[model samples]
Target chain A: MTSTETTPFREAPIQPGDLLLSIENLHACVEENEILRGVSLQIRAGEIHALMGRNGSGKSTLSKVVAGHPAYTVTAGSIHYRGQDLLGLAPEDRARSGVFLGFQYPVEIPGVSNLEFLRVSCNARRQHRGQEELDTFAFEDHVRETMAIVQMDPAFLERSVNEGFSGGEKKRNEVLQMALLEPLVAILDETDSGLDIDALRIVANGVKKLALPTTATLLITHYQRLLDAITPDFVHVMAAGRILRTGDKDLAMALEQRGYDWIEEADGSDTLQP
Target chain B: MSNVTQSRPRLWLETLLQVLAQWSGGGAAGQPAGARDWGLPTRRSEAWRFTDLRCLTQLDPTRLHTGTAAPHWPEAFRQAPSGQVSPRRLSLQLDGRGHWLSPQGEPPPWPHGLMPLPTGDIAPGQVLRTVIPSGTLLPLGAQLNGVTPGPSLGLQVSGPDPVHLDLAIQAEHAQAWLAPHVLLVLQPGARLCLNWHVAATAQAAVLPMVEARLGLGAQLEEATMAWGCPGAAFLGGSFIHQSPRSVYRRTNATWGWGLSRDEPFVRQSQGQAETHLHGLAVARGQSLLDTHSTVYFDGPAGRLRQRHQALADDRGHSVFNGRVVVPRVAQQTDASQLSRNLLLSTKARIDTKPQLEIVADDVQCTHGATVSCLQADELFYLQSRGIGRDQASRLLQRGFCEEILQRLPQSALLWPSLQSLLETPVPDQP
Candidate 1:
C-alpha cells in the first residue's frame, strides 16, 4: 500500500521498450513557411513529458503534425503512436486511434448542441473499436460523469459547442472531452494559455486523475508553472525546432530560473563544430 | 417573336383560353367590361423570361371539357375543416370533378373596395360569392383538386363578424388554375385569421390567386404553405389591401417542387396601416423556387417589415425579389426588407434582390440581401461530436427553416409532411 518513491528533482532515465510515442527527426511546414525542423522526442507510458520552449519554437506545429492537422505538411520524419505509423492516417482517424489534441484555440460551432456532438464523437471511437454504440441514456450518463471530473456545469452540454463560451470554460470543456474520450496518448497544446490560476489547477488535476498505467501525456506549454501542478517524469527543452536538452524535473526548475536564453547558449556551444 | 409563335402556349393558358371562350359565348354572366385588355404571357414580359411558353401551345383546345362532377378531395383536406373553432357557415369545396357548398348560411355582404381578378383571353372575369351574416363567426373551408387540365374555383367573402377560411388544394397529373377572388370586408374592430394550404403532386401544375381587402380598424393574420412534387409546377399570387388603422401579417412557407413561384403584393391606402410579410423557401434536387413580394406605402404614417429566407441544396435553385416603395404622399412611411440564403452544395445557387424606392422626404427605408455557404467550423464541430457530415448538414438546414416554419398556422400537422419531403431522397423524375 506504500506509494512509489517521489523524486523532488532528479529521476532515472526511461528504460528502452517503455516508449509510448516516438517522433523521429520530424520536419513540418505550414503553407510555404517551414515551422518545424528535425524535431525528435520520446514519451513513455505511465509518465508525464513536459515540452518547454519559447514562442515560435515550433511547439504548436509539432503537436499539430502529430495530430495530422491538414494545414501543417510533414515533408520528412515519422511519428509512431504506440508503434503504429501515424503519418498515413487522417486527422479524424488519428483521433479514433487514441490520439487527442487539446487545441489552443478551439473552434466555435453554433446551432450544434454540445451533448449531441460529444455522443457522436464517443460513438465514433467505440465504433472504430468494434463496440456497440451507446444509447441516449448511457451517453448522457457518461457525459455527466466526465463533466464532474472537469468541474464543468451540466447546462453547458445543452448549449452550442464552444459558442460564446468564456476562455476558462472552453479550456475546461476540452479537458472534459479528453476525459470522456480517454485517449491512450493525449497532447495538450498550449491549453493553459488563457486559463486563470484556479482553472489551470483544475485542468492539470483532471489530466492527473485520468492518466493510466498504459497512458502517456505530452504537456506542451510555454510556462513551467503547469509542470509544477502536474510534475512530469521527463522534461525536454526545445529551441529552434530541436530538443536542445533533456533532463529530469530539475531541468525545468533550471530553465525557470535562467529562462530560455541559457538553453540556447548551452546548445550553441555544443553544436559549434565540436 | 419567332420563338414565341413556334412555342406552344402553356397547358394552363390553353385551358384558360378555352374556358374564357365558352363563357364569352354564353353571354358573359360574370364578366367585367375590360376583360379583353388583360394581357397574356408574351416574349416581352419580364415574368415570362425563364418560363418557356412553346410547350404549352401544343395542348389541344379540344381537350378541354366541362362537367358537373367534382374531383375527389383527399381525406386529409375533408377532415381539416372540422377542426376549425368557429361555427360552420358558407363553405365551397371544389374536388375538381364537382363542387359542394353547405346551404346552412346566407350570402355575405359585398365589401365596397372589392377588386376582381384581371381577365384576358385565357381567364374570364368570374367570381364565387359567399356571404355570412354580421355578428356571426363563420368558419369556411375549401379543397380544390387539380387532376384534370381545366378546373378552377373563385371565392369572395364579406361580413362584419370575424371569419376563418381554411383552403387546401391538391393537384395531380394534369394542369389546373385557381383564381380565388377573396374580397374580405371586415367591419370596424373585426379580426380574421386565414389559413391556406396548396400542395401539388409530381405530375400536377397549379396556379392559385388569393386577394383580400381589409376594412378600417380591421386586423388579418394570414398564413399559406405550398409544396410541389418533383415534376410539378406552381404559380401563386396574393394581393392584400389595408384600410385606415388596419393591420395585416402574412407568412408563406414553401418546400420541394419542380418549379414554384410566389408573388405577394401589399398596398396600404390610409394612414396608420401596418403590414408584415415573412417567408421561407427550401429546394432540393434540381427544383426551382422563387418569391416576388412588393409592399407599397401610398398613405402617410404607414409601416412595413418583410423578411425572406431560402435554403438550396443538391442542384436546387432559389430566387427572391423583394421591393418596398414609398410614394411622395407617404409622409412618415417606414419600411425594411432582408433576404438571406444558404447554399449547401457547390452546384446549388441562389439569387436574391432587395430593392427600395422612396420618393418621400420624411420616410425611412432599408434593404439587404446575403448569400453564404454553411460555416466550415460549424460543420467540423458537429463532426467532432459524433454525427456524420451528412446528418449534421441536415440538422443545420432544418434549423434554417425553423424561423419561417414558426410563422405557419398549421405547422404542427404540416411539419411532418415538410420534413419527409426534405429528408426523402430526390426522385429522378421529369
Candidate 2:
C-alpha cells in the first residue's frame, strides 16, 4: 500500500492572500466502508471554520482522513495546503509540515512527563525545519510561555502526559500543545466536548489568542455554544459524509433553531450521498 | 561388564545426576528421595513451558566463577556515614570475599514483643554467622570490599524491636562469585527497614538469598538496587512467611548487567496478612534482566499486590514472571499483579507473563501484562519543545523509575548513583 495519495485537481490561482486549506471531492472509507463521500470545504488563513454535524454523520471520519489517520483509506480526494499536496505526506510528515490534529479524546501516556513530551515534539519540528535546537533553558522558557496562553499551572509540566488529567484539563492540554507547535493548519476535534463553563472560556480564549494571519483552524463541534465564545468566520453544515450547506455565522444559529430536521426534508432523500 | 559400565551415560540423565549431586553436596550426604524424584523439567511442566533450560545446562558452572579478591571499601563508602560525595560502587568484588562482620559496636535496644529467628539448620559450609540480640534496635551498616571471590556470609537477627540495616557491595575488573544468606525474625509488634545496594565490575557475579519471618503484628520494609558491570551476573532470591496481622513491603530496581535475575516468594500463613511488591528494571546494550515473584495465600483474609516495570534498549532483553495462588482454605483472599515494559529499540525484547491460580470461590484475583513502544504523540510533543528524542526517552524512563524510587529512604548519596544509571554510560559505583 502506498503511504500517500495524490490528486490532479488544481484550484483557481490562489488569490495573493487566501485560505490555507481547500478540500474538494473528498471521498474516504475504512475497509471498503465509505464514510466521507464527496465532501468539500475551505478555510482562510487566520480564520476559524466550525463544522457541525450529528452523530454518525462522518464528522470525525473527515478529520481523520484529512490528518492521514492510517485506519482511514482515502478513496478519492484532493487536499491542498499552502500549495502542497497534503494527501501525499505521512501523518508525521504532515505534522512536521505544520499540520496538527487535536484529538477529541487525548491519549494517556504513562511514565512520560508533559515537559519531556513537549520538548521532543518541538525538537522534531525544529529539526525538520533545519533550525537550531533549543537548549534546556530556552525550551523551558518556551514551555512557560505556551502554557501561559492556556492558563495551565506550571506544576502540571512535570506530571505524566495526560495520565490522570480531568476532562477539562485534558482539553486544555491539547490546546497547550497546539499553541506550542504553532501549526499552520490545525483541526481541533471536539475541543469543547467535556468542559465546564470556566474551562471552556479559558480554552476558547487560548485558541483565539493563538490564531494568526499565517495559520488556519478547523473547529469541529456538536453544539453552537462554543461558537458564541470563539466566533467562526464561516460555518458549514455536514450531513452523511457531505457538506449540506455553507454560509456565514448565521447558518449555525439557523441550524440550532431548525435542528438538522430541516436539512433532511430539504434534501428530500433519506439516504446520504456516498 | 566393566567396559559396559564405563560407557558414557545419556546426556540428559547425566545432567540430572549433576544437578542432583550439586543439591546433595556431591553425594557426600545421601540424596533425599523426594528431591531426586522431582526430575528435570520437560515441555510438560507449566512453569517451564516458555523457557528452555537445555542451553543453560550446557554451560560449565565452574567457568561462571570469578576468582579475584574483593576490593577494599571505596573511599566513598568509607565516608558514606559522614555524607561525603563519592563515586558509585560495584555490585560484586573480590577482596572482602568471606563472611566477616565489622567489629562489634553498641546498638540500641529494640522495642518489646519482637521475635527473632531461632538458630536452625546452619548450611554445612557457612563461613560467617552474626546474631542480633532480641529487643535490640540496632542500626547495622556494612561495606563489603575487595576483588577476590568465593566468600559466603550469613546473618540471623531475632528480636521484638525495630532494626535498620544498610549494606553495600562493590567489585571492580575481577571475576568472582559471592553468596550471602540473610535471615530475619520479627516478634509481635516489631518493625524493620532493610536497604541493600550492590555494584559489580565487568567480571563479577553475586548470588544472595534472604529469608524472613514476620510474627503477629510485625512489619517489614525492604528495598534493593543493583548496578553491575558490563559482564557481571547477579542472582537473588527472597522468601517471606507472614503470620496473622503482619505486613511486608518490598521494592527492587536494577540497571542493565551482563546477566541479572531476581526471584521473590511470599507466603501468607494466617488471616489478616498483607504483602506488597514493587520492582523496576532498566536494561541497555546486550544486557539481560529477569524478575520472577510468587505470592501464595495459605490462610483466609489475606491480600497481596505486586507491580513490575521494565525498560529495555540497545538489543537488551527483559523477562518477568509473576504468579498469585490462592488455595481452597484461603478464603476472602485478594491478589493482583501487573507487569509493564517499554522497548526503546526495535531489537529490544521483553517477555512478560502474569498468572493466577485460584481455588477459592469468594476470592478476588487479577493479573495483567503489557508491552509497548513509546507513544508517537508523546514523543512528538517532547521533540517539539526542543528536547531531542534521546533525551526525551531518558526523561520518560526516569519518570517510570520514580514511583519505586520514592519509596526508598532519604539518602543523598543514593540519588546521584540512581541518576547516573538512568543516563547513558552506567556509572561504576553503587
TM-score for candidate 1: 0.71
lDDT of 1 by residue, A127-245 (tens): 65555667779999989988988799999998877888999899899898888777778898888889899999998899899877778888888788888898888777778888787
Residue range B1-430, candidate 1, lDDT tens digits: 2435533443444344445455445322323333333334664755545443332233244543222122233344434343332352223333444232322122222223221223441221111111122332211111121112333333333444556555555555344433333444455666766666667653544556555566787888888777777766666766667788888888888877787777777778665799989988887887788787777777899988888999988888898878777779998888878898999889988888787788899987878888988866555444443344565566566656756776666522443456554564211110
When summed lDDT is taken over every stretch of 10 residues in candidate 2 chain B, the lowest stretch is: B138-147
lDDT, candidate 2, B1-430, per-residue tens? 2434532323443443444345335651343333333334444655444433333233344344433333344344345432222222112222343443321211212223322233554441121122122242211110111111233333344454555555555655454545555666666777776667767765666666566777788888888877875677777766677888899999888885777767777778765799999998888897778786778787898988888999888988888889788889999998888898888899988989887888999988888888888766655444333344455556667767766666666641353467556675211110
DockQ of each: 0.14, 0.16
**Each model: TM-score of chain B?**
0.74, 0.73
Compare the candidates by TM-score and give the number of the best one. Answer: 2
Worst 10 residues of 1 chain A by lDDT: A1-10
Report how far off residue B307 is in candidate 1 (Å): 4.7
Clashes of each: 23, 69
Root-mean-square deviation (CA) per prediction: 10.1, 8.5
- Worst window of 10 by summed lDDT in candidate 1 chain B: B138-147
- For model 1, the TM-score of its B chain against the native B chain is 0.74
